[model samples]
Target: MLHVSDIHAYYGQSHVLQGVSLDVGKGEVVSLLGRNGSGKTTTLLTIMGYLSPAPGAITWDGQQIGGLPPYRISRMGLGFVPQERGIFPSLTVLENLTVAARRGLRGEWTLDRVLDLFPRLRERAANRGSQLSGGEQQMLSIGRALLLNPSLLILDEPSEGLAPLIVQEIIAILHEVRAGGLPILIVEQNIRAAFAVASRHYILSKGRVCFTGTTDELRDNEAALHQHLGV
Candidate 1:
């Protein structure tokens, strides 16, 4: 569903993504794994059009979208959940979902569907974003993205800063979403969570793809894990 090939990006002349290439097929869950400053987040930002790639192609469903604006890319069926969990602090849960809602191609993700996915969100429908716990806020973030009805979901660090149980819950939610056939590209620091939900993995080192394989392949290659991911 998404392809990024030989993409190079820079932040004011400091090169970030150097010839990074990866693909997420339809209904596939892929994880981009790397240590801090390895350009995993930068790759997502480039794909979302927040950072433009000067020399390569980013294609969605076979059309190039290298320099398109973020909103335009989003309207083309890509939903992004940043690490910061950009929910409006003053908006109630329902209001937040309603504001970003967009009819998807399949028309499968309705407000009720999202609420069903996260029952705690239904319980706190009236609560302001700031009033929820970190895990609840993370759930709201994913829920809000689902309201967009995106063909592909891009999540950055969905399991970061949460308790183990909450991380497990998030992993389960991702598995459910994957079962519904929504493709995902996740940038994750939590290796366990990433491995749990991702069928395929890409490890980046110094702004380049150093390894790409299935979960079992990664499991057997501890050297790659330690060298590129420091795991």
Candidate 2:
């Protein structure tokens, strides 16, 4: 569904993402795992065109989208949930979803379906984004993205800072969301939860893809897991 090849990105000539590459297949959940500042978030931002890569390409369904604007890339079926959860603090839960609930190019994602995916969204429908719990805010963030009906959902650090139980619920919901038929691109620090839901995994180091393979492949290579992921 998505392809990123030999991509290189920079922030004011700092030169991050040196020849990074990976792919997300249709109806699959893929995880990108690495230590902090390994460039996982940058990779997703680049794919969504938030930061254009200096070299290489990001293609969706075979069309090159390397240099497009962020809005253009998003309109073309890319939905991103950043680590900060970018919710509108003043908007009510429903309003938050409504504000972002456009199907952009193709009309498939809807608020109703978003609530179906997250029952808590229905329960807190009237609360402002600031009034919701951290877990609720995360759900709202995910719901907001779902309303876009993206062909591929990119979630960066969805489990970060949440309690263990909430983390488990979020993981379950992510698995359920993927089961509902959309490809998922997850960048997570929670190795166990990430491995549970991801069909394949990639480990980044020094802003490059040092390892890429199925979950089982990663599981079997104990040394590789320790050296790259410390798992």
Candidate 3:
């Protein structure tokens, strides 16, 4: 339910997302894969309006949101979980989710539902964020996002810095999330996790979309993966 067309963004004088375009249909999961400097994160930031796109368009459900403020975009049912996992270190797990709790179109996600999606969070409901492990923190991040009941979820590096088992758990959780029919736009370095939940993939190189296809197409085209993602 989101479309980005030829968007160009910049940080100071340095161009970041150059003519990058992609789309996420309703209930679809798409992953953006790229090397460290490929502007994947920048594209997300631009869509969320943290960085305005000067030369392109970003539309959600048909309305143009190219330069809207982040809060305004979020209010329109777009949720973003950045790579930093912006959980409040001092707040209890329940408190964190409660803080971002809001009603959306379906109102299908509640604190209890999110806690069910992450049972470990239920056990640590009263614990502070700093007391949790890396995996718990990641779960908390995604849980907090779900509390918003966003129509489209944008996640940056959800599988970064976690152990294999934890990554698998996160992937399973994402699979369940996908089953719930929420469209997702994710930027993940973990190829396995990205492929597990994403039906489609977009590979960026030097700030532009160099490749776009389904997971099976990506698997068959190993040369493109090696060229754009160095995988």
Candidate whose lDDT is highest: 1
Q: Which ten residues in a row have the lowest lDDT in candidate 3?
A: 99-108
The local lDDT score (0 to 100) that residue 164 gets in candidate 2 is 91
lDDT of candidate 3 over 1-91, digit per residue (tens): 7999999988888988779999999999999999898998899999999998888999999999999999889889998898999999999
lDDT of 1 by residue, 24-138 (tens): 9988999999999999889999999998888999999999999999989988999999889999999999988888774334467889999999999999999999999999999
Candidate 2 residue pairs in clash (backbone atoms < 3 Å): none
1 or 3, greater by lDDT? 1
**What do the candidate models score in CA lDDT, each in turn?**
0.92, 0.88, 0.91
Backbone clashes in model 1: 0
What is the Cα root-mean-square deviation between model 3 and the actual structure?
1.3
CA RMSD per model (angstroms): 1.2, 1.4, 1.3
